[model samples]
Target: MATGIPRTKWQSAPHHIQPNGLNSGNTDVHLSYEGKKPELEILNTPPANLRQLWPSNAGHVTPNRLYYGDNLPILAALAQDGSVRGHVRVVYIDPPYATRSVFQSRNQTDAYMDLLEGAHYLEFLRERLILLRALLADDGSIYVHLDDNMVFLVKAVMDEVFGRANFRNWITRKKCNPKNYTRKTFGNVADYILFYTKTENYVWHRPVEPRTEARAAKEYQYVEPGTGRRYKKVPVHAPGVRNGETGKPWRGKNPPPGKHWQYPPRVLDEMDARGEIYWSPTGNPRRKIYFDQSQGVPVQDIWLEYRDAHNQNIEVSGYPTEKNPAMLQRIIEASSNPGDLVLDCFSGSGTTLNMASHTGRRWIGMDNSREAISATLRRFAKGLEPMGNFASKLESAEREEESEDTLSLFGPEETAKPSPAKTDRHHAITDFALIAQEPGADDLADAVGQWLEWKGESRIMQFREETVPYKTGKPQKLHRAKRRKQRR
Candidate 1:
């Protein structure tokens, strides 16, 4: 028998080593279970039949998209579509956490069920992730939001799907206030977001926050005597030894032992000449960083300021498990640029889509819950109330003392303080197409019909009615009831 290729030649094969020069050993380190299918099989899964809820008109701009269906099949269809195959820039998903509970809305209406557990849940997410990966652009990023219950397990699955090398940050966010729990464990007020990239090259805009007065005072303590500017001095040398000019002595001094100057001698001389360098009496040199020149402090992994709405003054869609809009704003700004497509498959109160629209990014949101759809539509039509400030009850009491006006929701008493105009509050995009998948599209149409009837003239009229045929080869028309007289 012919002798097999030499070991060196086999090891030198392209498949044996990754582009980054890391050895990709033959052994596959992946999670294996009874129901896990091959990646190829998952990719080949049948695509769903997407039916537009309304016909698009010429007046509409580049309309965003909203889907009402199971995300898996919808994602499968998107994966095969040439336009969306690899064009999505950002994806943020907050799927069910396998808590085995039925989540409801504020009115006790059933929203969704999270009954899958163990291997079944794993497979469920794995399949969707595989399709999402295919739909992601080469320079794209995805954030998977989850609670403590399934974060660790899902992290492993994410590592397997997105590759361990592509993993970015496990961002921990304080989702709520302190909880007084009877359980033996610590209070669970934090949730995690697993960030990942499609490839080594990805879009990233650094996020920063204005430093607090206390923090600014603590960090920029030194004040320049001449310019009265707040500045901080840092070491002029960096770690590591160099044999070039950076290691050479400048003037009468050299870099500290085993270290090198951060800049070349000529550059250091320029900085010193320009008054950007500080010199000590002992002949040590340091770089001066001015507080006025700084943009702000870099945002870190730990987040504490983005707690959920806990007060009645904060306006919300009344959708259970709704997230803070500011949190989604930060993520959208950091990971994507204007006009880039942002997707959220588990679009619960449509917070992601709303923020994306507000931030000038195109978005696509999908959810299977009928209640979620109704809530999202209503939020888009009726603007959210402005958040009221209650930093101190004394301040509020003082304001009340100054004015005899009383705030009331009914009668002439409402004249004291009217709600802010719709232009001042957050509202949904006027142009977006709604789509529902087949087999259940008819039912979704009926539900939407009822919602439109309930809303009457208040319903958004941007979308024109259309008769779309589903898989059953039957055309379903969205009906609107006659306007009901306003109640006294």
Candidate 2:
């Protein structure tokens, strides 16, 4: 009999019942459920039949790809593709949260159905995650966005797949404004993102935000008498006793109990001589940190600024559940650098792909929903309208009165005027190939046709035949159609 603590139904199940041969020795705990497929079975999913609708521009090697298909087979195909497998540097997915509701675009078009629940949804996500893991490079990173509905359960599944040691951060984001709930529960305005790395060594560019004047004044209250520089004082001692020179006393003063000098005795003496150390009225020493020397405040896990479109002033793709572009920008900038491959299998509004492209990263986006594909295509072709407040703010800043005699900490400020604001509203998307998973699929063709009609174009580009190699089964032939050129 199991003692000490009672196990839940999932935890009490036999070790052999779980897929992937998960056991106590390998994984700490597993979420056992009926109809769970083995990892091998999931990874062996049939590769998608692929055909390119539009070829990339000349001299553009490794062009971006957009796929219209079920992401499971698409991911599997990518995992087997020589150029993509083990080459993806970043993956950001905002999958359906098993809300059991039908989502539609702002124009009343059906986007997708999130009907899966219980063990079925878990299995569905796990299958895709396995393939995503296979596509990740050794130093790659992934961020999974979800809400409270199924984030906890998925967290467990991710731990099993990505290994517990690779888990980085459980970031919380304020998704929307506060809601006045009629129910007993508190207002639901936040969601979560689970960040994980493929290995111990992963690419990371630390994200920082500009320090606001209010925050700077509050944090750096002290002003130097001679230099007029804003600064703050921090403790010169840190926790934990040491046996090195830092543990020894300097200037006849020892480190406090259970503490050690942050610097060596000689280093502290040099800093004191250079006036980098501050002496308190009571004679306590602290190191001075200047505000002008700081790059910025390091961003924290709880994000409150990058909220979703709430008011009419915010510009969006009209896709239901579209994420903030700024939020995606931060994630892409932090995880990957220029020319890195970024993958988003559940690319709803193509926000991740757009941000990746804007940041000079290669991107691949896949989605099965016709509405989603259409929205993404429209976003790429005709850029979203600039945010109402953003444009107005820029104009106002540019119109600010320029003064030549403005005083500064050092001396009078120079008479340099702010640069003119860029008013171009469209994003010039790099050339990318639009792929259809099945040859002559009516749904995909219809989506593309709708997009062309919306853009006032009559000609339809023909799809070029291509075969995606598979481990098992013969390659299927893709449908070929004649291209129709637009009338001049």
Candidate 3:
């Protein structure tokens, strides 16, 4: 490839096209270039150890946390920390778009992924892909985002690194409206996203549930024969134990077919007497589940949620690097089950963690940029307003025990300081380099790393470690559990 763009200018007169010959050296046309700046400092102080970069929980945890650091160093730390090994279900990265924009950090060499003498930008992402693949669970998937410029190149490397056989889909998503450029023939209308699965057995959420018309017409078509009352049926079984002292069959002629009864004989008799049991003319029994109980269509993967944060984003951060929430939500929803740990090492503006928590998934977010970190924290604060209503119900249960300790303890302090609002990643890295060189942050860094791992929900699983698990063939009630909320 040509090392760089050559200088050029159009001659004013069409007939004077060859006039450029004489004025060539002293012509208005001029080439552009730059002298080098100091970028890399050979680490006089030993480079941060790769093994210790990760906090304890990095290799494990679903619906995990976000981490802020040089992603490459963090990846090395993960190689040892093992927090993500065989744990990640999906990887969705909106990698740098290869616009050849500036990338600066304390160590200048860290920024030069592709700006070298004979570098191909694709060469940069290749090394990261190797580790990212290692961290993926056997049955996992990955999605990589790019623009038209490098889509094909990135795709080929992804195929090579992750195995072409595991290829999933290439999505052409509408990124924005239009752009105008002098030499450009076509205005960019969209960019592309490449999806790949780790293995064929990977789990994928089907956005829609199937409806059997036969069942729908028979049960959900609740137009009564005579009274014409539109009442849908629901199981009449009152979940727990029943029947005086001994639990007996209640909902039907049988107790869930396999398990012991939920209610006693009398209650079962009462239910039968009330016609709660919808029996065929043959006297067979079954329960009715209504139509109104169903929520709307399950959310699909094609995201239309967050727009480029122009006006709305200013309402958010007005930051250039802020990611689309709709995109973040889709990634979180599709890859993680509720309560799973989610991590965003890049953690720009905390969009990933914010959206994850909004959907009830736990998250970890970190950013070298204090601005990004503060932006995320504020966004999360706004989110807490909605969470307050949902959590208010639970607050009543815990209040009596911790009555003296107020909710204010959970709130942010007046001293909370937000980072600079819109520093780019380069400047952010520069600031972090300076901070890393300074002395006081060791304790704070460790604390920040640890706090990112805390998800209050993990305590329950820890508590249950000693208890014997329930045995098979014993009936268990799973009524309260429904389809976990799918968000995007």
Best by lDDT: 2
Better structure of 2 and 3 per lDDT: 2
Q: For every candidate structure, what is the RMSD over all alpha carbons to the true structure, in angstroms?
A: 11.1, 10.8, 23.7
Better of 1 and 3 by lDDT: 1
Residue 485 alpha-carbon offset, candidate 2, angstroms: 20
lDDT of 1 by residue, 410-484 (tens): 232111111122235555455676778865655565556645555463344422244342221213122111223
What candidate 2 gets wrong by more than 4 Å, as runs, is 1-27, 56-61, 310-312, 385-424, 450-488
Query: TM-score of each candidate?
Result: 0.80, 0.81, 0.46
lDDT of each: 0.74, 0.76, 0.46
Clashes of each: 0, 0, 22
Where does candidate 3 stray beyond 4 Å?
A: 1-65, 103-120, 179-184, 208-306, 311-314, 364-370, 381-488
lDDT per residue (tens digit) for residues 127-174 in model 2: 999999999999999999999999999999999999989999999987
> Per-residue alpha-carbon lDDT of model 3 for 111-165, expressed as tens digits?
3222322134555466567767766778777778777877876777777677777
Which residue pairs in model 1 clash with each other? none
